[model samples]
Target: MKYKTFALSALALAASSAALAQSSTGSVTLYGVADANVQVLDGASSLTRVQSGGLNGSRFGLRGTEDLGSGLRAFFVLESGINLDNGSNGQNSFWGRQAYVGLATPYGKVSLGRQYGSLYNLSSDFSQFSNNSFGASTAVIGGFGGYEPVRGGDGSAATNGGPTRINNSIKFESQNYSGFSAGALWGAGEVAGDTKGNRVADIYGRYTQGGFDAMLSYVDDKANTVGLKTRTVSGAASYSFGPYKVNGGVISVNDRSIANADGEGYWLGGSYALGQHTFKTQYVESKNKGGLVDGKTQAFGVGYQYDLSKRTALYSSLTQFKNDGNGYVARAASSLPANLTSASDRDVTEFVAGIRHSF
Candidate 1:
């Protein structure tokens, strides 16, 4: 009887040790964002359907990391988009937004699978609107033009190269040095031969010190579906002085399929806070040089927000776009139809009021 009791105790100890070992080496986390709003267009005949992520898209995701020791670790992320209004998938894919697995260490991090290109990542930080918010109109205004239809597939803009979220890609991010860091990415065509020319490549770098930050990035693609062969170069900077912050950036796009289709764009934006109220404004412009036509478009926006609490806020914004010469086609307005008549020429405007919460 004494021998049997000792044996059972020893087994229990061994099992507990194994479980603790596993817990120390790996971990998984679940996280997400939920956002919704009511939107109306000025030109529309009547108030239209309501939606979410109007200021920001809704999403959920799973992420995990495993310590491999010696400063090395394995990590993976799977994120999915969701429509909060109907409780349905946003892009109709399990991991349509981002799906990646990679390894990281003190030197830097290298990731594989699907991910955002260096150019998009860099540009997003400078804009007032990001993801699905009011700033999303930038895509149509040529702020960061490329193949944009693959991920959203709304036919509102040209497809940049692959999906905004790339596939079969390898990305490398460098460690910060003196408040500066850099990164590069390459997406494989997965075709038999001719790997270099048929694929995509991007490089970017940024610096941040004190209240000032700036970044530059470039992307090149030889043969992306949609016959999209493009090169984009962009940079942005911002500074905070007192209770106000100022930001600005420029982006240039060169497309192979269209003659003189190269374009350059810039934006100037700022924000100020007084007690519980915050005010913001932005001015953006785009011009096309060698395309079938020559023209320029400009957009102006203003917004105000009142924080009701740490996690909730109410906000309102209004934006307008004006086209000059042949540039009417390049205007960015939420009121414009997803499918515009090629022959029509007109200005655009959008206004939105909503509430946002973060948990």
Candidate 2:
């Protein structure tokens, strides 16, 4: 990825401003994405409006790295999600998107703070749509709810869709050895009396060689107070040949404490790139069991993108969803229109066109 960088120091050169001066060898880069779109939803409720993060989430971030000598480095990232539609905080918190600092060594990297889990990383990397929240996002596909931008503070097992961002956590990621790497993370429950009151543990492994990429991740969330536990496992793979790419993944989640909470979801998709234009399509479905939630949801989506330049692009997508029994999956979960409801299972069709620019 290309980013605009501002050099504040050049070989020990000092600046008049103390904040901008760095005595060590390092660099800080500022980057962000601005994406917005017009969307139309047709279903139990029909509506049209402008939304943010059509192709990608809108956010600004500052990332820096400092060389600590002898194959060691210190790095940090602080990202803030932005809602382009109304200029508000996208993830509620000023730095809800990501906020972490770590030290990188030859063997591996250790970090602490809020960050994404392995499941989210794998989903975004393997999905043709990049798992965006809008359009053909895989967010509504799984029994786990896909990827959630906001995470529970108590490590609640109810959000079992797979942890997107976690707070008060420590993570270790091994450096790539040959074509493989692995990582593990643990989030402290922070409950005074019980250590496992609201704890989270996750692990993942990945391999990348030539045109093939594969990943697997597992997450365990425990809510001791509520006697609820969630376990999730997922795997995904992608292969690229020429200008064509194929990808697929499956996710399974089980929560014995809650009825209708155990479900499985899977998706398959492919894409073709021709010069500056790309076309893609995918099918995703989920099956749930128990009680009124004993239902199934399926969707088909197609999309097109035209890159006008390295930093800007035009894109559009459409997805049609079908609900059987009481399944209530839709295009976007958090940003759903107020008029839309899950009163009864119904079909939904979403159309969106947008522009994205990165800086």
Candidate 2 lDDT, tens digit per residue, 36-149?
999888888888888888778899999999988899999999999898999998556788778899999999999998878876687688887776665455665532233221
What are the models' TM-scores? 0.85, 0.86
lDDT of 1 by residue, 216-313 (tens): 87777665354556687778888888889888888777766644367777778888998889888888777776657677767788888888887677
Clashes of each: 10, 1
Cα deviation at 246, candidate 2, in Å, is 0.5
The candidate maximizing TM-score is 2
Worst 10 residues of 1 by lDDT: 149-158
Clashing pairs in model 1, backbone N/Cα/C closer than 3 A: 53-56, 55-133, 129-135, 146-160, 147-159, 147-160, 148-159, 148-160, 260-290, 260-291
Task: List candidate 2 segments past 4 Å from native.
Answer: 1-24, 142-162, 224-228, 327-335, 341-345
- Give me the runs in candidate 1 sitting further than 4 Å from their true place: 1-5, 44-47, 85-88, 131-137, 140-163, 258-260, 325-335, 338-345
